[model samples]
Target: MGADVIERYVTDLGSRLQGSRRQVRDLLTETRDSLTDATEAHLDDGLTEAEAQERAVEEFGPVREIAHEYQAELAVAYGTRTLVWLAIVLPLMHMAWEYGRMLLIGPWQDFGTMPPAWYLFIAQANDLTSGIASGVALVALILGRILARKYDTRLLAKVGAGVAVVAVGTVLLGNISIILATAHLDAARLVQSAPMLVATLISWIVIIRFGLLARRCLSCATIVA
Candidate 1:
């Protein structure tokens, strides 16, 4: 029974190793094909299959190590892309929907019939804060992309720190603005503004998630390097 168990464990490990090897091989092949095509176009020089294979393998470093690195990098890229899209599209849609509701149903329907000046001030503050946060998140996503490409650990850490700070600051500012606006308005109006609060919370979560992803990617890079 012990021998059988040992055999089964070894078999499972062998299968996993085979799957990993195949994945790494596919990635290496794609990388090599792209590079070879570009090199041929730029230099009008073609490499033999053996030469190209050797060069690609050399550039990719150790196969096992690079496979692990690629896994982390791909995860970070996927997460960052999701966060970027959410940051860019969600806030704008929220603001537009809020404004549309106010326009159609009147400010009282939404904001409890506040003075026009107060309405405008609140709207402006909301838009400004949302825009700033989205912009910062977008910038951080871009920086994360750049750092991922370069595998720059230090820069990734810096970008993550900046994102965390901006996300926290935006949340604080948004909460304060909402409180101040609602103080002069009815409690019911504050409750009506829950959508904005929810959106802000979602944005905060996305920012924090992506920031953590960046930091984790950087940490993995440090280990690999």
Candidate 2:
């Protein structure tokens, strides 16, 4: 019965929180360990099993409240991770779609020949931009992991946010360049790429959210320091 109660509480907490799955699992495992230890201590003190279990649960406080506290911390880490992923993926997908579309329908100067010099230049530029964005995203991912693990260090958080901003900015600029360079910005293209556009909007939102949270964490760290 005590084990069942602990399982249910951890399950409920897991449903309510947002973060890395591994981290959440680790937290639950730690909670279980602490509760078990407390229960064992109570039992050693001559308490009944039921009484010990109840005391253990009470000592840990309410699951919902503790989960809320964890949510506050993990939400920022989740946002940081989400932004890093979108920064890396969205641009690459957009560039791939653009290039694929061009290969299928673009005008070629000769039969079975390569695209024009301008086309090659633009493609190279897009690839280079995407590469730089991906590099920034990698940096952001590494720094975000450090921030999440340490849950402190204002400098690391700031650097992570800065890298995320650069990555998102690069993606934005790449998208704009693709739009300007292509002749497919008509209603048909808009309808076809609507999902991608919506994803871009969501990416922007994630970037803004992560950036704000990172700044808030930095501010708090400064105050604590």
List TM-scores for all candidates, in order: 0.45, 0.49
Task: Write one digit per residue (lDDT tens) for candidate 1, span 79-168.
Answer: 454446546764665576567556544555343444567656776776676567677777777777687568663344345444645554
Which run of 10 residues does model 1 get worst, by summed lDDT? Answer: 10-19
Score candidate 1 by lDDT. Answer: 0.52
Once fitted onto the true fold, the runs of candidate 2 whose alpha carbons sit more than 4 angstroms away are 1-4, 72-125, 138-225
Best by TM-score: 2
Q: lDDT of model 1 at residue 28?
A: 52
> What is candidate 2's CA lDDT for residue 142?
72
TM-score for candidate 1, residues paired by index: 0.45
| Candidate 1 local lDDT, residue 68 | 53
